[model samples]
Structure formats: C-alpha cells, structure tokens
Target: DDTPYDTQFCNWTVQSRFPSNQVTLGPWVNPTFLVGDFGLLRESFKNQEWGFQNWTTRRLQLTYNGLSWRDTAQVQFSMRRKAYWYTINIVIPSQIMWVMCYSSLYIRPDASPARVSLVVLSILTLITLSNRAFDMLPIVSEPVWITDYLFILNILCCAHLAQFILLHSALRAQDRRKKRKQQQQQQD
Candidate 1:
C-alpha cells in the first residue's frame, strides 16, 4: 500500500493523574524608566599641527535590567520578576557601525597587518566588551552608555581581517614587481 499523506499517528487515551493548580500574573509595580546617553570618540590628528582637529565621539546608550525584583521573604507566594530595559532602536546604530568597517579596504598595505589586525581586533573587542558592559549595566551607573557595540565589533573584526589580507596582497604584489625588475635588469 502507498504511504498515506494525511495519516493520524497520535492516539488520545485517558490516564489517571492528579490535577495541578498554578497561576501567573503581571508584576505588582510598573517598571521604572531612566534615560541615559554616551558616545564613542575617534581621534584624528597630525604629527604637530594645531590646524588639525582633535577627536570625535558618537552618542550611545546603556541599558539596565528594569526595576523589579522578588524579595527573599516573598519567594513562597506572590509572583514577582526582575525588570529589564535596553537602548531603544539600538539596531540602527549597530548596523551603522558594522557598515563603517568597509572603509578599512581603503588603507594601503604598507602598514603591518599583525599590528593593524590587533588594533582592529582590539576595536572589535572593545565594542564587544562595551556591549556586554552595556548589557549588564545597572540603572545607577555611569553617565555615558554603550550601544551598537556588538555590531561595530563585528565590522571591526571583518575590517581587521581585510586589512591583513590587503597587506598580504600588497606584499605579494611588491615581491612580484621586484622579481620582474630584477629579471629585466639581468636581461639588459
């Protein structure tokens, strides 16, 4: 017989079992709201040029688990939960940070990849740590906050690798150029 496309495989049967009673409801108190802001600074300066601008910063956010907690005494009865909150619209800034990493390809390969890669990774790691910190940040912490850190970290990671690859590629190109020059000179 051909396999049935709409075959019922489950059977319902009554079995003796004790009934359980449980109930859950929203927390008693409304969550408290607090607004905070922060920024990321990027410094661009010349060797010794006062004409050069200093550093720049981007504002961000720090979120705290909302204001709700169950006391040890109330653990037996009356349900309660820890409150939580996060930077509103965090994804927008995060995506922007990730997209910014595309600029790394513009850099020349003269710089060392090992060093640049570390810096890139550092930036990414900083972003990640900042993100984690932001995530863990409590209601009462610092004035500044961190948002989109993970997204930026992701971009920095990609850019760091790209820089390394670019450096390697440039190194290979230079090597080929030198080899060609040497061969031409020998022929001459």
Candidate 2:
C-alpha cells in the first residue's frame, strides 16, 4: 500500500466477501536483519517507515446487505512504525533557527543598518528553511505542530523587527536634536 512516511501501518484487515468454509490467518513478522551500519537508516524506507512493532492476525466474520446466507472473513494485522529521521533533520534545525532569530532581538537598536540587515536576513532564512521543511512532508489541510511553531515564531520575529526599526528611527531623531542643541550652545 502507498502510505505516507509518517503513518504507522497497523491494524490492516484483509476482507473476503465470498462465503468461506473457514478463514485461518497466521501472520508473522520477519524483521529485516540490519547490520550496525544500516540499522539507523531502517526508517528511511520509501513511502513507509520501518515497522518494528509486533504483528497480530485475527479472524473475524462479517455480514453484507442483510443477507443471512452470505458470509465474509477478515484477517487483521498490526505493526508499529517509526519516523525519526524527519524529526531529527527538519524539526530540530527549524527550532534552532527560530532560537537564533529570537536572540537577534538582543542586538542594539541604535545600529539601524546592522539591525535592519540582520532582521531581513533572518526573515529570509527562516522562510526558506520553513519552505524546505514543508516540502519534506505530504500536503495536508491541517497544519502540523512544527508548521504552527514556525509560523508563530515568524510572526514574533517580524513584530520585533518592526519595533526595532521604530526604535532606531526614534534614536536617530533624538541624536539629531542633540546635535542641533550643541551647535546652538556653541554659537551663543
């Protein structure tokens, strides 16, 4: 089955509509033997991550269309899956980037050029990294936790950047007023 990488492929049922004498299912899991070198990469499987959980098979009966004569058999299996690489690679890096952006607020607001440049670069980098992270995951209508975090962090960074710009403008005007007062005092 073509499933998303993050999905845990568990509890699959194989149903047969035809009348069955009996449905016997003995499902077993043959774990892939991985060497030390390849074990960490087990979850890197295409489409589905590595499923290490126990598999169970159970037989069940079903009725269809209110037909008393018709019988159905189903075999269900459960397996556990893991998706660690995406979290380690994409999630961690994005969080670190946000931390860096937050720390930029400590820069002196009087340094207008440096502060502006840093804010612009941080915004651009965050947006680019966020895009890359989203591209790694399948598109969905709801936003994931990481997506929400990134969006909120981006908003905070933008608000702080705007505040810094305003502070810088105010400081520049104050400095101009001070210079005018000093000049007037010297002439007097």
Candidate 3:
C-alpha cells in the first residue's frame, strides 16, 4: 500500500460466436483500428484520486469452452493514485505539527502553560491527521506506511511533553528549596 505506484490489470475478452473451426480471431493490425475517439477513451478512465496509466490489448487467442472453441481478445488497463494529493494533505501538515511540537522545547520551563499547550495541541492535531489519513484508506489487517509515519510523529510529541514535564518538576523543586532557605534565614 505504501508503494508510490499502483498497477491494475483488467482482462476484457471479445469472444466470437463462430467456433475456431469456422472463424479465427487476430490482433488488430492497424494502431487505430477499433479505437474510435482517443479523447473519450481518456476521459472515461479519468479519476480525481487515481491518474490514468497506460493500457494495452493482448493478442487474440483461441480457447475451448467444452462445447466449442472461440476466439477472444483481451484489453487491460492500469492506474495509480496521485502521490501529490497524499503528500499535500497528510505529509506536509504532519510535518508542520511535528515542528510545532519540537519548538515547544525551546520555550522557558517556567512558562508551563504555553509549553504544555503547544505540545498538547500538536498531539491532538496529529491524532486528527492520523484518523483522517486512515479514513482515506481501505481497512486491512496490515499496517499502512502513512499510519506508521503519524505514529512516529505522535511518539515524538509525547517525548516532547515528557521533557517539558521533567523540566517543570525540576523548576518547581528549585523554587521550593529557595523558599525553604529564605524562611530559615528570616527565622534566624
């Protein structure tokens, strides 16, 4: 699922009513033999999420179906989802959220509200993004690469929050020691 390119092959058989003994099927000699309108063909396969890939027609063949033999021709088409859409919608935004989470580390430890809020917001945004990405994909037993990327981002956000918690705790402890020393000095 993580692959950038997706290929799908469809076989369409045009079977002849006459048996191989009476008639035979052969590949089109002319490039534009049966193809009527090129524009219409392209438009029919056009998709928003998936771009149209190349299509090919296989050589004609004679096959037996118990009762009689027939001639058949196959046409296959391939298409792939546009990577730019995913990159724009999911990847870029998640990267921005990660940057925001990382930036919280540079904030002063005393500013607990700002630092905590930033990390928390980043975590929430990442969760929403992950959900959105997952919704776009079909459900499968195996994990997807986009989900894995988001999971890593969530972990990084958590690590940033943990760092902030530790810093805040140490700052509080230092303040408490200073207060205790001042109280003792005043009493003395």
Candidate 4:
C-alpha cells in the first residue's frame, strides 16, 4: 500500500475456465438499477482535493507454445488520484517567500541593523517551513520540489546577510578615512 506521492495507480484481474464457461461468466450487462443513491455519495467523494481518472481495459488472446496451449482473457480497471495539498500549501508559499527574499536585496545597505534582523528572521522561517515539508512527505532519498525550493531560499537569505556584512565594512572604512582627513587639516 505504499503510494508514491503524486503518482498515478491502477489494479485489475481476469477470470477464465476454458471457453465453455465464457458464455455464462461474462458478456454481463449493466444492471438496470443501482442499489442506492450512490451517485449522490460519489459527489461527496469528489469534494476532496483530488482528481480521479476511472478506466477499464480488456483483451482476449490464444497461443500454442511447444510445451502447451494457452488461452487468456484479461481485464484491467484503473483509477488515478492526485492530491492538491503540495500545490496549495507548499508551492505557493515557497514562491512568495522567494520573491520576498529577493526584494530584501533592495533595502538600504546602511540600515545594517534592520537588514541583519530581517535576514535572521527569514532564515528561521525557512527552516521551520523546510521541517514542515519533510514531515508532510514520505521519507525518501531524493528531495521533493518544495524541499529544493526551500534550500535555495535559504542560500539566498545567507547571501543577503553576507552582502550586509560587506557593506558594513566598506562604510566603516569610509568613516575612518574621513576622520584621518579632518585630523590632518586641523594639524595644518
């Protein structure tokens, strides 16, 4: 019962006992009446965040191998279901966060305190969201899309922090240079 996340699935079987029984067993017709208002129940099932595809395939074949003769009839019933939670919760938020992270780059670099604090908070928020993504998915070797997105977002946050530190150093250098110039002028 291990269903991979966001994967399509199907299952079915066939029954046969010589060609003689085929007439009695199948060529079955749909019943004129259903047991209940199952159609109403079906509508309820559709309300969830799932898309389903119902399908059926059947085939008949006859063959003679060197050792034996084989006659086969196969029937396959398939149902595909896709959940929307990842798209709604994970993807949308990650995209919004990415935009926010990029936008922070425009903040004035002289506002070092504000920039540092915002970057720290962004890192923490991304971490919490990544943990949530891990919890939601089945444990697997490869990362899911949301996980990858979060990792990239974290890198961007760190880059922003680094830029802030670099800007702080350059501004400090300028201040020292100005102080030296003022002292030299006073001595003259």
- In terms of TM-score, the best-performing candidate is 3
**What are the per-residue Cα lDDT tens digits for candidate 1 across 1-188?**
11111122222122112223212222323223111111111122122212222222222122224433221111011111122222323434454544444444566656565456555655665565555655654444334324334544665666667667777888889999999999999999
* Per-model lDDT: 0.41, 0.59, 0.75, 0.60
Local lDDT at 15 for model 2: 53
RMSD of 3: 4.4
Give the runs in model 1 whose Cα sits over 4 Å from its true position.
Answer: 1-85, 88-100, 111-123, 130-156
37, model 4: CA deviation in Å?
21
Off by over 4 Å in 4: 1-5, 14-49, 59-83
lDDT at residue 118 of model 1 (Cα atoms): 50
Which prediction has the highest lDDT against the true structure? 3
Instruction: Give all TM-scores, in the order shown.
Output: 0.31, 0.66, 0.80, 0.65
Q: Rank the candidates by lDDT, best first.
A: 3, 4, 2, 1
Candidate 3 vs. true structure, TM-score:
0.80
Model 2 per-residue lDDT tens digits across residues 1-188:
22224435444444554665544333223336321211222233334455544333444566656663333333233343345765676667666766666676777766667777766777777787678768866777765766676687778779868888788778889999999999999999
Worst 10 residues of 1 by lDDT: 71-80
> What pairs collide in candidate 1?
66-83, 66-84
Report the C-alpha lDDT of model 4 over 72-153, residue by residue, as the tens digit. 4443323433546766676677667666666667788787766777778878778887888888777777656668777988
Per-residue alpha-carbon lDDT of model 3 for 1-188, expressed as tens digits? 66433455565556678764332234344544433212124334567777765666554547566776576556566677788877898899999999999999888888889999999999999999998987887777776788899999999999999988888899899999999999999999
Question: Which pairs of residues clash in candidate 2, taking residues 3 or more apart in a chain or in different chains?
Answer: none
Better of 1 and 2 by TM-score: 2
